[model samples]
Target: MAIAKGYAATDASKPLTPFTFERREPNADDVVIDIKFAGICHSDIHTVRNEWKNAVYPIVPGHEIAGIVSAVGSAVTRFKAGDRVGVGCFVDSCVGCAARDLDREQYMPGLVGTYNDFEADGKTRTQGGYSDSIVVKEGYVMSIPDNLPLDASAPLLCAGITLYSPLRHWNAGPGKKVAIVGMGGLGHMGVKLGAAMGADITVLSQSLSKKEDGLKLGAKEYYATSDEETFKKLAGTFDLIICTVSAEIDWNAYLGLLKVDGAFVVVGIPENAIPVHAFSLVPGRKSISGSMIGSIKETQEMLDFCGKHNIVSEIETINIQQVNEAYERVLKSDVRYRFVIDIASLAA
Candidate 1:
């Protein structure tokens, strides 16, 4: 066993504190990673705080991980001791399942989250990457492109892939008019990526606060949803709308912005039940859908795609000690975009 140190949520309400734990020694299919940067995902907050109604005590919560490979087991062939790598939302899925075979393992019944989940053994808990080191299965590890810096690229493991998967699946390339709701972490990536894919990207934010940043990030149009006229002007305009905020807004209003046969995809998790009327979709033949983080193959593709486009999340780097404060900042929407932890602080 290898001793590991990280911040842990001991209870639902208490702050995270330094915790020591054991990481299993590398097996033949395992790769030991020196986790350098861990991105603070909103999902991490949800899990740690028991907002998701499934909290395990002493949980070390983080999934958007970027690091360097320090060692590899004998059976691992794709990674070496010095490779730059990442681990995303999930770590494992049932082998030989149809979803796994199709490289859509995110939908597999046995999908194991990188954090706050049980291993395939069902007894051993799986810890996450708000730490100095991690041991991951070779199949679950990703090769981050050399051109992308590890710190900035960390959030791509989760946030980037989360947006990329839906964009790709919905064919948000040339000739598509796409609207991204919310100008925060997930929504900003949607604009950047949808634009890169040749879509006519627009930003539908709560207010104009992030208008400048949205345009700079490739959003051709930016409108404040707070203005009634904004929704009126854009009604029946978009071919696809991706909502990335957890705020309970008028779902029907967003649906009305889509063209006939258009789709509204939700990647964000709202706290309460979203009330959607059947008329929201029946009139326009619109469809509502949801996407989790991408499969391993898809996530690798997202990393390579970001590499080619020189795209990375807009990040504010924080040390391990500031994670609790970071969480509060996140709740207030105080971050410019994503928050990445410099894991070296854990060692200090």
Candidate 2:
């Protein structure tokens, strides 16, 4: 067993604090990573506070991870010592299962999350990137491009891929009008990626405060969602709408903005269910769909796509000691975009 240092919530409603735990020695297919940075995700707050029923206690919450390869099992061939790499929301899945694809192992009956869940072995609870080190299968890890800094690249594992998958799936490209709801972590990435894909990008934000930033990030248009007139003007204007806000939204109002046969893709997981009436979709043949993080194959494709376009998340770097405070700011939407933890500060 290898001793690892991390921060963990001793129980629900408790702040994360310093903790020590053990990691299994690397198997032949595993690659040991020395974690460099971790991103603070809103879902981390929900799970730590027990807002999400499936959350397990003493959980170490983090999925956006970036690091360097420190050691590789003898059988590992994809990476070597000193390689830059990253791990996302999951670590391992059943590779032999039917649902498993070349890019993702099937985890329908049982999926091992990056944290707060048990591994296939059943005895060990999987910890996450909140720690100083991790051992993941080579197949599940991705190569971080040398052009992108590791800190900003961390959130790409989650927020970046979350938006990219839907954009690609729905074919947001040249001549398509794409509207991204919310201007925070995920939305900002949506704007950049959507624009990079040759779409006419717009930002639908609650206020005009982020309008300038949104435009700078590739949005060709910005509108305040709080304004009644804004909705009237955009009615039947968009080909695709990506909502990244976790709060309950006026679904019908947003749906009204979609053009005929358009789609509204949801990536946020709201705490409570919001009622969706059938009328919202029936009239224009509008569609509402949801997406999880991308498949491992898709994630790699996203990274390559971003790398090719020189795209990366806009982040505010915080020290490890400020992690709890960062959580508070995230709740208030006080972050400029995303918060990335500098693990070097953990040594302090």
Candidate 3:
């Protein structure tokens, strides 16, 4: 076993503070990474605050992780010391099979979260990347291309993969009109990726506050969702509409924006259940569905695609101690885009 240092929220109401913990020693198939940067995902905030009402106290909340391989156990062959890598939302799965490059583990019955959940053992809780280091099986790690910087590339583990999976699944490509709702962390990445795929990209935001940023990020058009005319003008316009906002919205109205036989895919989790009128989908044969993050294979594909296209998140780097302030800013949607914690602050 190895001792680890990190920041954790003792309970829902308490802010995160420095804490000490343990990591399982590297097994022959495991790789130990010296965490470099950890992105502050909105999901991390929700879990720590017990907003989902299933949080485990003293939880270290982070899943978008980028790091350098510090050590590899004897059987590890995929990585060695000093390789750039990333770990996304999970560590292990329920299949009872442990091997390098586990297949589609995210959908398996025993899927384990990177934090606030149990490992495959159902006893030893799995912590996250808001720490000095992480020990994961070699299969769960991803290689970061040299072109992508550690800090900005960190969010791709969660935010990047989250959007990529849906876009690719829906075949957002040349000739496809795609609309991304909201302009926050997930929305911004969706714009970049959707545009890169040659889809005609549009951004539907509540306000025009980030319109310039949206256009610069590759959105062909940006609309203020607040304008009733905006929705009316764009009705039956998009082939695919991806709603990235976590807040409850008029889903039926958004569904009306899709063309006949078009699809509406949701990646964000709204606290409240969405009510959809039958007419929303009956007339056009439009489909409304949800997609989780990508499989490990697809995540690697997303990374490679991003690497080739010079895609990385727009992020603000902060010292680890500033996480509490960052969290508050994130909730207020005050961040320019994303916040990445510089793990060196923890080392200090």
Which number leads on TM-score? 1
Model 3 Cα lDDT, one tens digit per residue, 221-288: 99999999988999999999999997878899899999999999989888788898889999999999
lDDT of 2 by residue, 7-98 (tens): 99988777899888998889999999999999988888888888878877788778999999999999999999999999999887775652
Where is model 3 poorest over a 10-residue stretch in terms of lDDT?
A: 95-104
- The RMSD of every model to the true structure, in order and in angstroms, is 1.0, 1.4, 1.7
Greater lDDT among 2 and 3 belongs to: 3
TM-score of 1: 0.98
Candidate 2 global CA lDDT score: 0.90
Q: What is the C-alpha lDDT of each candidate?
A: 0.93, 0.90, 0.92
Residue-wise C-alpha lDDT for candidate 1, range 103-146, written one tens digit per residue: 78788798888888899889778899998899999999999999
Show where candidate 1 strays beyond 4 Å.
98-100
How high is each candidate's TM-score? 0.98, 0.97, 0.97
Candidate 1 vs 2: which has more TM-score: 1
